[model samples]
Target: MEALGDRESWAAVVKEEEEEEEEEEEEGDSANNIGDAIASTDDEDALKRRISAHPLYGKLVEMHLDCLKVSVMGDVAGDLDHHETRYQQQPKDCNKYPQKMLHQSDLDHFMEAYCVALSKLREAMEEPQQKSMAFISSMHSQLQEMSAIPIAHSNAPAHPLPPPTSSSGK
Candidate 1:
C-alpha cells in the first residue's frame, strides 16, 4: 500500500516537471517569434539604425556614397557635353543682332546654373562622408576599449603562465 502511494506521488512530480519544461519552451518560442517580427518590420529609420550598428556599415555606406558620387559626376559630364554640342551646333553668323545677344546671355546663365548645381552636389556628398568617417572612428575606438577589457579569468593571479618544460632534456 505504501509503495503504491510513493509511485503515485512520483508520477505527479514527473508530470509537473514536464509541464514546467513545456511552458519554458513555449515562452522561448514566443520570444524568438517577437524578435523575428520586429526584424521584419518596414521602418526605414529602424533599418538604418540596425545597419549602422553592424561592423560593415561604414564600408557599405562608403561604397554606396561612392556610387552616388560617380553617378552625379557622370550626370554633370553628360550635361557639359550636351552644352558643348549645342554651342557647336549654333550658327556662327549673327544676322539678327538682338536675338544673337539674347541667346548668348541665356546660354551663359544656364552654364552658370549648371556649375552651381555641381558644386552643391559635391558639397552634399562630402558632408555625409565626413560624418560617416567620424562615426566609424568612434565605433573603432569603442570596439578597442571593449576588447581591452579582461572578461574571462579576471579574478585569477596576474602572473604569466609558466613556460612549458622541454620534452627532451635540452
Candidate 2:
C-alpha cells in the first residue's frame, strides 16, 4: 500500500477540513425574506419584474442618509467654512450635507446611466460635425424616433410660468 503520511501531517490536514465553511448562517426574518423571494421566482424575466416591483424605499433611504449627513458633515463643514465663505467658494447649499448623494452602488448605477445619456448626446452632436447634411438629418431622425417614446421627466411638461415668490416676481 502506498498510503503513508506523517501522523502530524494527517492530523493538520484533518484539522483544516474540520474548520471549513465557517460562515454563520443568518437566522430569522432576514433569511425568511430571501427564501420567499427565491421561491417565488418562476424565470429570469419574472424574477426581474418581481425585484423591480418589490416595494422600493429608495427615496426614503436617500432621505435618511441625507439626515445623517446633515448631522455629521454639516457640523464639520460649519466649523471649516462660514456661510459667507461657503457661498463665495462653492455657491451651492449641497455642501451642508456634503454626502447627501447616492450610495457607492447607486452612484455606479447613476454613472452608467449618465454615460449612456452622454454617448447619445455626443452621437447627436457628431452628426452635424460629420460634414454631411444627409448624415446629420439621419441622426436627427434617429433622435426624433427616440424622443417619441419619451423618457420619464421629459413626458411631464414644465409649468408654463414660474410661481411668484414671496419677495419678488414680475
Candidate 3:
C-alpha cells in the first residue's frame, strides 16, 4: 500500500479517499462537526468560564507587532537614522569588519534588556505560586486555631455537679 502502483491508479485512489473524507466532514447528521462545535454552544457564560479555567488563558505572551514609526526631529531623528548611512555606504574590508556589525555597547544593552525580560517572566510565573502558598499558610493557621479550640474546651475545669438527691424513705 505504501508503494504507488502507477500515476493513474494512485491518483484515482487519492481522489476517492479525498472525496470520502470530504463527505464525512460535510455530513450534517453527525454531531461532531468541529467547525460548528464551539459556535453552537448555547451558553456563552459557560464557554467563557471554561476558557478562563484553561491553564494558558492568561499566561500566553501577547506581542505587539503593529507599531508605527513616527518621524522625529533633532537628536532623536539623528539616532533613528544613524544606521541608514551605514547601509548606503559600502565597506572597504567587508571580511574583516565583523566588529562593525555589532558593538560592545549594543551587546551590553541587549544582555541587560534580556535579563530584564527573563526576570519579568520569572516573576510572572512565580506570582501565582506565591499567592497559592500564602493561601495554604492561612488555611494552616485556621486549622490550627480550630483544633486549639477543642483542646482549650477539653482542658477547662469541669463544672461542679449538684449532689445526688437523697433516696426516699423506704
Q: How many clashes does each candidate structure show, in the order listed?
A: 0, 0, 0
Which 10-residue span in candidate 2 carries the lowest summed lDDT? 51-60
What pairs collide in candidate 2? Answer: none
Residues 33-77, candidate 3, lDDT per residue (tens digit)?
Answer: 654666567556554543333333222211100010122336664
How do the residues 32-112 of candidate 1 rate in per-residue lDDT, one tens digit apiece? 989877777756555454443443333344444444554555577576556555655765443333443334454455445
Q: Per-residue lDDT of 31-70 in model 2, one digit per residue for the tens?
A: 8878777776656565453333322323323333333333
Which rank order by TM-score, best down to worst?
1, 3, 2
Candidates ranked by lDDT, best first?
Answer: 1, 3, 2
lDDT of each: 0.64, 0.51, 0.52
Clashing pairs in 1: none
TM-score, candidate 3, is 0.29
Q: TM-score of each candidate?
A: 0.31, 0.20, 0.29
* Best model per TM-score: 1
